[model samples]
Target: MLADGTIGEEELRYLADLYAAEVRTSDDAIGSFLDGLAERGLLDSSIVAFLSDHGEAIGEHGWIGHGIFHEEILAVPLLIRFPGGEWAGRYSEPVEHIDLAPTLLDRLGIPIPEGMQGASLLPLLRGEPAALAPDRMRVSQRAHGIGLSFADAPGLRIYFRRTPSGPDHLEVFDLGADPSEEHNLAADPASRETWMPRLERYLEWTRSRVAEDRAFRVKGSGIQEEDKGMLRALGYLGEEE
Candidate 1:
């Protein structure tokens, strides 16, 4: 869909239909597996979690894939089915992927690691109103130096795109008023003054964290001409790259 940089409505509709059908198929499979487990008395003591890493953009924001700061790509479904359906209720609070590990540990009565950044959602799952701190911020980033830096309290979102040899680009949006991110508030003096400092602090923290972790490094392996051609055909790598 992204190869020609144009996505027709009919194409989008077709993709949507295929997605729905796949979802139904997956649901049926899971249901059958769980039913078998229950019949064998195995599911009475199990916890099930259904989640996606991220959502697809479809035609939103002129994008079709993930790895963006847009709400369509950031928001994902998370359904936790506790044993015996205990404390089953809908939660509307915003949570990050990092919270999943801590939540599972907490449920299993294990202590969360001291260096973990996410809080456990056990309280929320137990019908308690577990609200995030007022100063809490959520961040999303891609390997291409694009970042979404935002604070829930201030309702401010900054889309930062860094170039290898050029000035970084920034687009700010007030998510409270414009969830679609249609307006750029970065040029406004007051908005910049209010949000820039927080963004800088977060960036500094990220840099320090990266410096402390030397276990993994990103290195590119030379791609063969055939692989490059295949990727280009798949609309992943552009000719300029």
Candidate 2:
């Protein structure tokens, strides 16, 4: 569907239908699993969470895929059903994937390690206000090559590119005013004085984390031809693979 630059109405409808079908299938499978568990008297003792790493951009912002610092890709669905569904309500505040482990540990009565960067969301889950620190920021990154990352601050989001050639590039957006990210505020003089320093600090911290992660990384060879063929068949890898 994303082969061509242009996306027709038929493509859009097909994408929507495909997404709907996947959702229905997933729900049915989960429901069946839960029914079995209930029959075994174990349904009321589990915490289920449904989330996605990123969202797809069919044609938003003239883009057909994710890995961009756009709301269409960043804002994903997160549904958490606790053991009893108590305190079940919508939370409008921003949360990140890093918080999941800490939240789960906190809920399980386990202590969160000091080395973890994420704060627990247990208070919010209990219907209380769980405010993030003033300086706390959410960061998202690309997974391949000289990776790109973005720091999401209050009302502002700064995207930093860690390219191998030339100088690094930055793109800033005022999400409060333009949630669609239609405007670029990086060039605005007023935004620089406020956001640049924060971006620099966050970037330094992120670089350190990346370095530490690399220190413990394990190298792997390229996948086997059979595995590559299977990935291609599943529409995960490109046809060229």
Candidate 3:
């Protein structure tokens, strides 16, 4: 609750309530738009999705915004409402934003590109046989930290962090037991033995993947200022950053 250095608890509550009000206002607008679409009989025929590229941290772990390694910031839902309510249930497996495009293409019966790094969720959505293999481990990153967690055990997570003035840091937590991450299990042999090997393998693979991406990346002039403002309006820079 003391995430802000300058604000007292009263001010913080006021700000949080303001934020919630804004969110509700936006939700109301979206609901009205959807109602209009339904009135026009277009809601059933169109593919609609609501998702976010990143999540916010209010006061969890004293973090005030996105770009931190925690479930609060990384586990936002990727909700897609398929046309005609074809897939109408919740999904509990781990998935990433990269998978969205392939899911869309698969849903539309288009061939996915060979080089795409994500798998489609269409089969899983429709409850088809031979569902995509569940991804066991998911890795996420921010400017200073890289985190890994297992799909099978959602509550266990580990983080590797770079410090500006010291050696890197590692954190291990059983979030089920310590949702606030108040205990550090990094030095425990049992915890290290269970998670270190997986971290090592993932790091090695990441090195190679980074190299490949760099080698194949195409250079462009970068975003213009006007485009950046437009992107901010459309919610994508507000996405990654």
Candidate 2: segments with Cα more than 4 A from true spot: 1-9, 129-153, 165-168, 205-241
Off by over 4 Å in 3: 1-7, 128-155, 205-241
Tens digits of per-residue lDDT, candidate 1, 1-241, equal 2756467889989878887897799789889988997999978688888778877777776677666667777778887877888777887878877788888898999998999877788887777766444345555433344454565347877776664457987888888899888998989998777888878887788778665543442224467778877866755555654
The local distance difference test score of model 2 is 0.71
lDDT of 3: 0.69
Look at candidate 1 and give me any clashing residue pairs.
Answer: none
Error of 2 at 105 (Å): 2.1
Error of 1 at 38 (Å): 2.1
Instruction: Pick the TM-score winner.
Output: 1
The TM-scores, one per candidate, come to 0.77, 0.73, 0.75
Each model's backbone clash number: 0, 0, 1
Model 3: lowest-lDDT 10 consecutive positions: 143-152
State which candidate, 1 or 3, has the greater TM-score: 1
Candidate 2: give its CA RMSD in angstroms: 4.5
Q: What is the TM-score of candidate 2?
A: 0.73
- The candidate maximizing lDDT is 1
Candidate 1 wrongly placed segments (more than 4 Å): 1-5, 127-143, 165-167, 206-215, 218-241
